[model samples]
Target: MTLRNSDFDEIRVWDNENFVHPWEGMEHIGQNERTFTETADGIYVTTEAGKRLIDGPAGMWCVQIGYGNGEIADAMATQARDMAYFSPFNNANSVPARLAHEIAKRTPGDLNHVFFTTGGSTAVDTAIRFVHFRNNILGRPEKKIVISRQKAYHGSTFLAASVSGKERDKGWLDQAQGMSYFLPNVNPYIRPEGMSLQAFLDEKVADLENAILEIGADKVAAFIAEPILASGGVIVPPKGYHKRCLDICRKYDVLYISDEVVTGWGRLGHWFASEDVFDIVPDIITTAKGLTSGYVPMGACIISDALIDSVSGEKSQGATFSNGYTYSGHPVSAIAALKNIEIFEREGILEHVREVSPLFQERLTALGDFPIVGDTRGMGLVGCVECVVDSNSEDSLDLDKTVGARIDHHCQELGLILRPIINMCVFSPPLIINVSQINQMFDIMEKGIKLTTEDLAVKGLWSA
Candidate 1:
C-alpha cells in the first residue's frame, strides 16, 4: 500500500516538529529525515516508502513471537472494549491477576509474585524500590546500594538509569548518586590477553565478592544484571558466570535481581534465562519487552516467595509500600500479555527457537571470517558481530568512521535493519524467523560488511 505524497509530507513535518526521539541529538534530527515504519508483518516491517526490511533487532529485542500476530491484536481489541482502564493499586483486576498467576507458573523457583509496571524501566525501578523497602522493613536502612555490572543496560528511569553502567547513557544526565555501584563487564572477547575463560570468569566472580565485601554486606541491598548484556553489544559472559554471581550474592546476603528485560519470553529458548539457562533462581526477576511481545507496553518484576514472606511480618510498625504507577496493571496490557503467552504456548515458540538457534549462531559466527570482524558472540537468538580495524590486533575501530553504522546503512538498503552499537552490530530477530529468513538476513549482513570494507579501503581507513 502506498501513502500519498501529502500524507508522507504531513507525517514528516509533524514528526520533525513534534516527535522527540530517544538517544538522538536535536541537530542530527533537524538535519536528517527519519525513516517511518508504516506497517509490519511476520519478521519484516515496511517503511512509508514501501520498502520492506527485516527487523534484525526484533523491535528493540522484543517481539519474540514475531510481528502481525492477529490473535494478539484481537485480544487487545477485545479487552479494550470489555474494560480498558482499571487501577491495580490495592484493587483486584481479573486480567492482571490471571496473568500474574500464569507468569508465576512459568518463572523459576519461588519467584511467584508478579508486580506489574509500565515497561522494563519501571519494572527495574520498582524491583530496586522493593529491595529498599524490604531492607527498611528488616531494619537495615543502610542496605541501599545496588551493585550493577559495567555495560549493563537496566532502563531509562532515574533509579534504573542509576543502576545501569553504560557510561555514555549517563553522560548528560544526573544519576541517583551512591545508590548503585559497578563491576567490570564480563566480555569474553575483551578478557585479558592470556587469561583463560575460566580464569576470567573467576576474576569477574571474585570482583563481585570483593565489591560486596568493600561495600559491607550490611550496606548492599542487591546485585542486578542481565544474563547476557544485550544493548551493550551482546556481550556473552563465560560459562557459569551467572550461577557464580548468584552464589556470591547469596553469600553476601545481597538480593539477586536478574534483569531479563531482553532475555525473557523465549528470546533465549526459555521462558526465563536466570533459572532455565543459568541454573539459578534470583530473588527478583525484572522482565519487559517480550512479555506482551511488544504488542502493548508492559513489564513485570517477579518476586520470590521467600522475599515476600520476609517482608510480610508483623514485628515492626506497619509501613505501606506506596510505589505504583497509574497503569501498573492496565487491563488492556494485561490481556495483551495473556494473549502473547497464549501464542507462545499454542505455537510452541520456545521449541522453535531452540530448534533454529544453532543455525542462527552458526551463521552469525561465520561472519567472524571477515577481516574487519573481531568477534562473533551470543546465545540462543541474540548475537553480535564486533568489527575492528585489524582482526588480529586489540585496537578498536575508529569512532569517526562509525563502521557499524556504515554496515547498518548498507544492510538497510539491502533489505535488513540492524542495531549498530559503536563497532558492533547486534541481531535479535523474532523467534519465528525461519532458516531461510536467517540465511537472507546474514546474506544481507555479509554483503553490507563487504561493502563497508570496500568503502573503508577506498577511504584509506582499512585493508583486508
Candidate 2:
C-alpha cells in the first residue's frame, strides 16, 4: 500500500482543467501537465526540461534590467532581516518612506507624493480613484468621466478594465465605470493617405476637444494614457502627441494620468519617458515591472502636488477614500527597487539602451521583407514585429491569433520564450544586454519565423 502522508492525504488532485485565462494564455492550459521553469540567460529563459529559450518578451516586459542580480537579492534579504512587516495604518517602516521621498525626487514635475501598490494594475486603480476623489473635494462632483484611447491595456481589475480602451478586456466585465468620453490615440495606419503623422495627431486632439464638449467638459475628470502605448501593439504616438494631450487636459481642467508601467525605468533609454522624450508633466504616473526588475513585485502611482492639495485640503475629500491594498509600500519590494536602481546606475543601463537601440531597429526592420512581417517599430529596449496576413493589403493576419501562437510554441521548442501580445510579437529584453546578445535573440526569432511560415504553408495557410 502507498504511504498516505498527512499533507498528501489532505491534498487531492488539482483541477485546473478548462480554466479560462484572462489573457491569451488559454492556449497553453489545455496541454499536458505544465512544465516548470528554472533558469534565465542574459536575455533568455530555460524550462524545467533543460530547454534553453531566449526570453524574447523579457518576462512580459518586466525584466527591463535583465535577470539574476546578486545585489537585488542581498538588499531584499538585509531588509527582511531588519524589519519584515509594519502596517501603514498609523505606523510604517522608514525604508519605504525614505524610498518614496527618493522616488519623488526622480519623478516628473511636482509629482511630490508617491503612493505604492503591488503592481501596475493596482497603481492604475489607485490613480483613477484618487483623481475622482480630488474632483469631488473641489465640489465638481459632476466631473467623473475618465477618457482613455482605444485599444489601451490599463489593467485587468474590474475598475481598470472598465476604463481600459480595449473591448475584449470588457468582455467579462459588468456594469459601466460611471464614466465614458473615450477618444482615439492616433493610429497612423488608419490615417488618410495625404495626412501626415503630425496632422493626424492634431485631428486627434481636435477630436478630444469635441468629445469633451459632447460629454460636458465638467463630466470628464482625467485623461489617462501610456507614454507611447506599450501593450496596444506598441503604438508609437506621432510627434507632439503628448504635448497636445497636455494642452487639451489643461484646456478642459482634466487631470493628466501617464501609465508608465511599461515605459518607465531604462526601457525607453531614459529614466522616465515623459521627460526623456515627450516633455510633458502629468498629474499622475503609474509604474511597475522594472521597479524591481521582476526580482519582486512592486509598483508606484506618483502624484502631483495639485491633486494632493485638493484631497488633503481644509476638509475631508468627501469620498471615504478607503481604497488600497495591505501590501502597499511593501518594505522588501521597496528595498529591492532601490537596489535595482543602484544596479541600473552602476551598470549604466540607459547608456546601453542608447547604444544598441539603433542596432535593434536595423536588425528588426531588415526582416520586413518576410512575407507575413508587416511593421517593425519601437524605441529603445521595447519593440514589436507586427506580422500580418499580407503587408500590401494592410489587413491583420488571422493566423496571428492561432498560427502566430504556433510560431511562439515553435520558438519555445527552439528554446526561445516569447509572449505574443494581440497582433504583434513583442521584444523587451533586459536593459543590461549587449549587442551580440541582441543579434542572437533576433536571429532565433527570424529562424522561428521561417519555420512557422513553412509549417503554416504546409497546412495550406499560405495563399498567393
Candidate 3:
C-alpha cells in the first residue's frame, strides 16, 4: 500500500484526467497542478513527494482533533462492523439518535431536534427547507424570503448556495436568487473611512432591519448568519452586531439561523458559538465540518422545539416535512461524530482551544506588520491574512488576485499550506496544535508574506 513518488505521478495523471475538483476551472480541466497528500499525523500532512507541511487550513477548517486519530478510526470501524447502512427515512438507528441527543444537549436554547445530512451543504439545505415547511404549516406560505449577508458562505447545495452571498463565487453559476435577500457585507475592516465603530455597527444592524422592513416581515422567513464569516476572509463583524440583528429578527418575527459549519465543534472554544460567544440563541443552527472532525462526512440542522412543536401532533398528522438525504444519519458517520465529541470532552479540547486562542489571535494580528498586508482578523482558532497590491490604483483589483496565491506558494515551500481566497490566505490549524506549533506556523507565514512582498516589488506590481 506504500505509494512511491512514481505512483503519485501516475495518480496525478489519473486525477487530472478524471477527477473533477471543487471550483474547477474550465481551461484547467486536464492541466491543473495540485499537491497530492499521502498521509497525515498530528497537525501536519505529508505529500506524496515527501514534503511535510503544517495543515494551515486544517483540511478546509475541519480536522479539529487533527489527522490520524486512531481512536476515531477504531470507532468508525466498530460502527461499520455492527451496522453500516440503513434507511433512516422509515427505520431509526440508535447511533444517530444518540448523536442527536449529544448534540441537543450542547446546542444553545431550545434547538433540541436534530435532522442529519451528508455535509454542510445539505445541513443548510435542510434548514432552509424546514423554514419553508414551518411557514407553510403555520399558514404563511409567503414567508419564504431568507435573508443572508454579503460575503457569507453557507454551502454549495442549491438552497444553500442561493442564500450564500459570496459575490465572486456566484459569477458563473446559477442560484435560486429570488428565494433570498442579501444584506451588505459586515466586515468592520471595510467600514467607511471616517465612520466610528459604533456608527458602523449601527449601520450594519440597520441593514438587516431595513431589509426586513423593505421586504415586509410577513415575507421574511429567516436571517442566516455566520458568527464570523469564515470564507469571507474571517470577517469579524462589529461587537453586538449579531445580538442586535437577532433582536431585529425577533421584532419582525423572522427566524434566526446561525450557520456554524466552521464555528462549531470547538473552533470558538465552545460546542456552539451562537449563544456562548455572541449571546444569541438562533431558531435553527446548521453545523458540520468539525461535527465528525473530518473523520467522516456528516452535518446537522438543529431545530428549535418551538418550530417542531408547531408542526407536530394530531392537528397536522399527514403533513410530512418531506425533505431528506438517503445517507441522512448514516450509522458510521454518526458513530464517528459521537466519538469526535467524546474525544473533545475526554481531552478537554474546548478548554485547550480557549487557553491557546489568545496566542493564536495575537500572532495572527501581528501579520499586519507586513507592508502588503491589508488586514488580519480572526477569533478562536480561525484567521485570515489579506493582501493588497495597491488599493488606490486602477490595476489593484487585477494585481490583488495573485497576492494570496504567491503567499501560498511561498508558504507551501516553507512547509505550510494555506487556503487562499483571492487576495486572502486563511488559517485554521488543528485544534490539537500546541503553542510552539502556533509560533512555528506564524513564523513561516510571516516569512512567506515577506517573500511574496519582495516578489511583488521585483515584478513592479506593488510598492510599499
For candidate 1, report its TM-score: 0.97
lDDT of 3: 0.93
Residue pairs in candidate 1 whose N, alpha carbon or C atoms collide under 3 angstroms: none
Q: Positional deviation of 264 in candidate 3, in angstroms?
A: 0.3
Per-residue lDDT tens digits for candidate 2, residues 1-464, read: 33233332232223245444345445565443444456665666666555777677788788876667777778899999988777876677888898898788788889989889999889999998898777777788789888888878888776677778876666655836567556875667668889887789889888778888888888988888887777787888787888888898899898889999998988888778887788998999999998888888988899998777766746664556777788888899999888887778888888888989898888888767787777777888877777765434334445567556766777777667667765578778888778888888778788888887787688776653
Lowest-lDDT window of 10 residues in candidate 1?
392-401
Rank candidates, lDDT, best first: 3, 1, 2
Query: Count of backbone clashes for each model?
Result: 0, 4, 0
TM-score of each: 0.97, 0.91, 0.99
Which candidate, 1 or 3, has the higher TM-score? 3
Model 3 pairs whose backbones collide: none
Cα lDDT listed for each candidate: 0.90, 0.78, 0.93
Ranking by TM-score: 3, 1, 2
Which candidate leads the pack in lDDT? 3
User: Which has the greatest TM-score?
Assistant: 3
